[model samples]
Target: MLNHYPLWKYIILILVLLLGCLYAIPNLYGEDPAIQVTGTHGRMINEALLIQIKNALTHEAVQSKSIIWQSGEILVRFMNNELQLKAREIIQKVVGQNYIVALNLVPATPHWLSYFAAKPMKLGLDLRGGVHFLIEVDTDLMMDKIQKQNIETLHTYFNKKNMPYVAINTNDQNRIILRFRDESTCKIAYQSLSSYSPDIVIHKNAYNCLTVDISTDKVYKVREDAVKQNIHILRNRVTQLGLADTLVKRQGDNFIIVELPGIQDTARAKEILSATAMLEFRLVHLQSNIYNSIPNDFDIKETPEGQAVILDRKAILTGNHITNSVANMDEYNQPQVNISLDNIGGNIMATFTKSHIGKVIATLLIEYRDSGKKDARGHSLLEKHEEIINIASIQSPFSNSFRVSGINNIKEARQLSLLLRSGALTAPIRITEERIIGPSMAVQNIKKGLDACIWGLVSSIVFMVLRYKIFGLIATCALLANLVLIVSIMSILPGVTLTMPGIAGIVLTLVVAVDANILINERIKEELRNGRFAQQAIYVGYKEAFSSILDANITTLIKVVILYTVGSGSIQGFAITTAIGIATSMFTSMVGTRAMINLIYGRKRIDRLSI
Candidate 1:
């Protein structure tokens, strides 16, 4: 009666263990070497594309287990690494630049377990072998853009306020210069501008020219904002790639570090991450003197179809105004991109189209690519290219939504839609450093870590069984249950990545679990030696040992929490595994072992017990 548990307690224990077993089944299925094919530049991936990929694989004599289309990507699983490698090369040559072919590992989970959304925990970069890139943000271009915007803003404010100034222009040193008629007007303008723009400093010079300079603090803040914006945009774009366990974070003031676990396509990853797919809508100048020297407020650009066109300097609408975009077919069955704009952009489009019903409007696609040079500061030179992706005459007034036609193919339409959906990069970024972790290294790491865990577990089990006899064996069984519960919990939890440090945490957890069992067994022995009955000793031993075990686990949990709070990457992975282990160990050691002991020894009284 002293150590007996209710029937409901046994039911709950059975349910928990069964659920744990269910979730842990996927981990045993392991992973297969595979290659993923994704559309680039807005190419759509569907079931139809699978045939093409399969054909390419077959042409190269690459044996594949299966080919499946999932989440807008094609996954081709290979029977061996050699076939996977051969298939990658053949597929790249066959598909060309329209599709991005990357090497990856696909889960070989059974259909039954996958139906429940049970997946093996994702491995970290070190364990899974992936690509790591250190990208540098071009702060110079960001500052230049900011300065130009400020100059335009000041000019607009002066015009709206009816200030008396001869000319308003930006100097070579990036200062806004306002040339006034007299010192009185200059002084008044300086005071008004200073009061209005606290982020800048205004000074009047000898020639009555007022100079507005951005404050040092404001400049630093602009740089920081630019870096933060780039990081956010990069993350959004990378998410479109459907990568799991990917990490994108700031490494320093102007550098971002991206880790793509299980990603092997360094070239494609670099291209996607560095692409600045900014869009601009401009009106084509139809004046008769178009061949003459262009006005200062206009630019000359080439259309995608190879025709040169003159466009207004100011864009009527930009990528920032785009709210939604999708790839679709026009009435003629030609591929096109349908775009929806925000309210302000909608109003602007409606007004412009209403005034110039027959004028041609151009959608400019601006991209930045590495220029293969480095300045004095060691930053890569980036060149900007602007081309008109679409040019169409306005037949009627419309707002909010419009379609861009004349796309060469469906792949181009898909690429445009993806770029519009992902939004534009705030600034150009270049990869300064890139490192690829091969699959062989990852396999070696996995083998070594698993071996270490197996040995640690075996040693813990042997010690537990040798020390306390039957009770020790019961503890060992509970320890095994703890491991199952930990793995199950990790498998079910979203975004949890397992790493080498996580393996160490699991090994450490086994030691702590065995220690807890030892404490309870020792307490039971003490109670038995003091002449207590077997059932009473079991109850008393558990009751006294609970406090010591709780206190110890809580202390370690506090440390793990701190570690998780301050750490990043693999350190956090370690903390997560340890924290989960501590929790599951407490449940199994206290409740699991107690339940087993109650069923075996609680119902009967004995003067002598094995301890």
Candidate 2:
């Protein structure tokens, strides 16, 4: 019976302890994998060399490769011998090709021993320590999109009614005013605009001249939609980046927030956020009016350097043609580009080059920083500037495509290709707000968290053993088993991270597991004193404890899950650890303690078990 036990309780205790031992074996005593490296010693690394090293070390051939920079060494960790050997091969490839020096095989320790020896997992920023950023989204681009949609609708209204326009000008702020040479034509254009601008209330002075104001409420709704869409696209881009445990969600009215832990570079974070995934292809229109190559009356645009600048009538070759692109060298030794086009973009390029073989079609490649730029002439050329690219050679089957020249370096070319592949965003994304956490803060927080957990766990264990004596010892055993299961899950499954709150949850769960055992032991003692036999008392105690166990654990489980679902950043640590602890506690308290009770009742000829 659970209320009283003799020698057999020791056997059940040994078996429970063995289960804990079983879980710990794989993590601690497992063999370390050795990978060989031929060249390159410990130091003297450059950016290009670092890229090659990282690529090699992170290659798929290695299993469970972990890269860490600490104590002036690049640490690599792996599990499989074969994968580690592959890492060696990768190291050989880089070291042999690039540098010459004696090699040292770096040593690595398994992360499981750090509270996760029973269950090992990688450390997150909240544990391992690094910067955490909460970046706010910008909604200016959304406003621009709404204005374009409105402008198009108004343009269609004029074109449909056969109204002639000298020109139409719209501002980035979404205001529209119709301009015409003749007063009568202007009046007619206004009539056409009036039909489409039903929500636009006209504010005119006593004169016939007019001003059309759009509904502010309608514009706000449109801006909200655009912001939501931009958020969606940014989410996709972040997903493509493949960061683990990254958090992204809409913040409210005008912004969304992205939380990236373990990301340290403040400038790099800004660059990633501002990167415009825009792709465009435009038909080159050389400013030939100055040199007599113009068609009819097209005027040439001049630059501040006293040279004629070309323009794109419209994009003819867009980034969509690029199926794949890489920054590699060409035959002539110039930093040129090679593009593999998709069917649509390829067909467009092929058709254009085939039609204009010898003629120099001036296509421009424009460099933008954060957003569109202004030209030296003070014109807003950010949205429309291009570097002039002339087609020199064409290559294709019948479909036809040409290679152009003008890239300066590998980094620039790669950036251009990636931007093109991502495509021009429908609009710009301004950084409305930014928050960055320094590494020193992250490390200090983790240390404080660990201190709290150590004290909480040690105190709980001492209390349990002191209060219930031998039964408390059994509860402690069950708690140990629970800890083992949780750690094994963390180490093997890889979804777990030992964040700060994760330690707190472990401590909290340890107390809960102890509570469950105490309830069962108290019930066993009550039944034995009420004249029930030892075996019957043990059975009834376990049976009565079942419902309470389920109810308490389930309620806590629900709360933990809710925290995981909505809470951001390390709040997720609380969720995962709480959930795992609840699950393991239920098993250790009800099932595990009962099994020990059964073993005791079967062996002893007593009327009571240990309390």
Candidate 3:
């Protein structure tokens, strides 16, 4: 029976979904074609060309800028293969200099045009492709921070014990091995350090010399954690940049493959992809008031503590406490930022605001430019010359939802809204690998993938029809339903990049589901031949099929679990579709078959159970 829901409610839901799709469809375009004007190492490796290119593209004045572009691919393979440079000499000369690479004029067609055309994404070497990368996440900086945190314990202890130790400036903060101006002072510093040290095990060797060693395993774990964190942030960052349905997946020990549809805005892609998006909420302390006067660049507000002055930099709250953010307006209607927080964040903001009412708090804002202009020296003047509107008063006392205002116009408002929706990574995310496929490559992949899918489906149908006959048609119906569900899911969901691996996963699941129907049909036939009636055979066939289906699906589910747990990006896609397919398939073949049988023969007197 079709349970009818209220028409109004269903219509509202559909409208919401449709509106969301229309709003987000633009992001599918990916980054624009970056106009190429200069190469660092070639005759093109000079400011003159860059300036000329900028002028030709946008008659506006160019400014100093650092626009990072990506090939949408790793600069080198895990084996350290040097990235192919259009002009190596130009690249070397241009790094940290006033020049930017032009991707539009690059001889190759970019990777994203076909992607926008809704082409299937290509796999990296790790997936359907061949090559793979394994990067060793850098942890020197983190280790150094830990070392400093540990050393500070010694400082606190020494202050009480009157021990003098000299500080040394080393890049690694992990080893805060201070040199005691005198050996006697070392003993006092060591003694003081132990008092506050967490699990400090001081040991003396035969020479009676001190050995200060940290938990190497613990430090290693921290680095590993940092790498994982970095990976997640990188994923978020790439997504935020709207990389045209990009796939940033984990491969092996410490590797990720960023696959694009075609060649991409490699330069800007690199800048956005390579960096981490670290966001912190600093309290604003106003010295130069903004109430009577326009806001200043920087200032400080006196807090009750008097020592810790809040930074005047615009900051209502950090991203951590954000429950849900949407683009909306405020009470006064001056385009204010309206932010609703969770219980914890709400409590904090409420208390802070209540205590400091009628005061100023500017949320610290950082906007990374999608693209920028270059000056005579050929530097990205994105931050210097680019315009950014500061939003405030959005933070409020609610755990439900909120929106930020102060968008001077619709354009700025739209960008900010996208940032919140996609989420700003805790750290800057960079695209280590970027490639924009040309139209030719995209068309080829589309044809190849489509052919494979057609052949697979045809083969499945032939087998099903030949073996089960009438039952095969039923299974085919379920299969079609499965396909519809999968496509519908892909359309409704964001961050779903249809790739070759994803297709393979779907194919694999479809095969498994077909097998379920076949098994049930064969069981029913065996029972009927044993002299059971049609309805009785159907009931028994379904009952017995349950155990086998459970056993099979459970094992397959285990593999999917491992795939999701261990696999990175593309593998994740496989795991997701596979799991969803398994779940939905079971329903169609089992529950759906029962419904069909009931509908077909509610109280029939059918004899032979033949197709």
Best-matching candidate per lDDT: 1
Q: Against the true structure, what is each candidate's TM-score?
A: 0.86, 0.64, 0.50
Candidate 1 similarity to native, TM-score: 0.86
Instruction: Point out the worst 10-residue segment of candidate 1 by lDDT.
Output: 40-49
Query: Global CA lDDT of candidate 1, please?
Result: 0.84
- Writing each residue's lDDT as its tens digit, candidate 3 over 1-611 gives 22123446545545533443443343333222223332221112334444433343233222212233232211211111122232333333434343344332121223443353432222332322211222234354345556666666656766676666565333332334456666666665556555544444454323223445566567556756766766765666566544455555555544466654333345544544433333334544445344455356544333212333435454556655664445545566544344556788777777676666545344333434324565465533333111122324434433335455545543344444444434433322222233455433544665676687778878888888787776777777677666655554554465565566777887887888888998899898989989998878877888888999989999999999999899876688888778877886786688655555655653677786544
lDDT values, one for every candidate: 0.84, 0.58, 0.52
Model 3 spans with C-alpha error above 4 angstroms: 1-137, 144-183, 194-196, 199-218, 228-263, 278-446, 460-486, 489-501, 509-572, 575-611
Model 2: worst 10 consecutive residues (lDDT sum): 35-44
Across residues 59-130, which tens digit of lDDT does each residue of candidate 1 receive? 767789988887577888987788888888888887776688888887888888867788887888888888
Task: Show where candidate 1 strays beyond 4 Å.
Answer: 45-53, 69-72, 153-196, 203-211, 284-313, 323-347, 358-362, 387-418, 605-607
Cα lDDT of model 2 overall? Answer: 0.58
By TM-score, the better pick of 2 and 3 is: 2
C-alpha lDDT of candidate 3 relative to the true structure: 0.52
TM-score of 2: 0.64
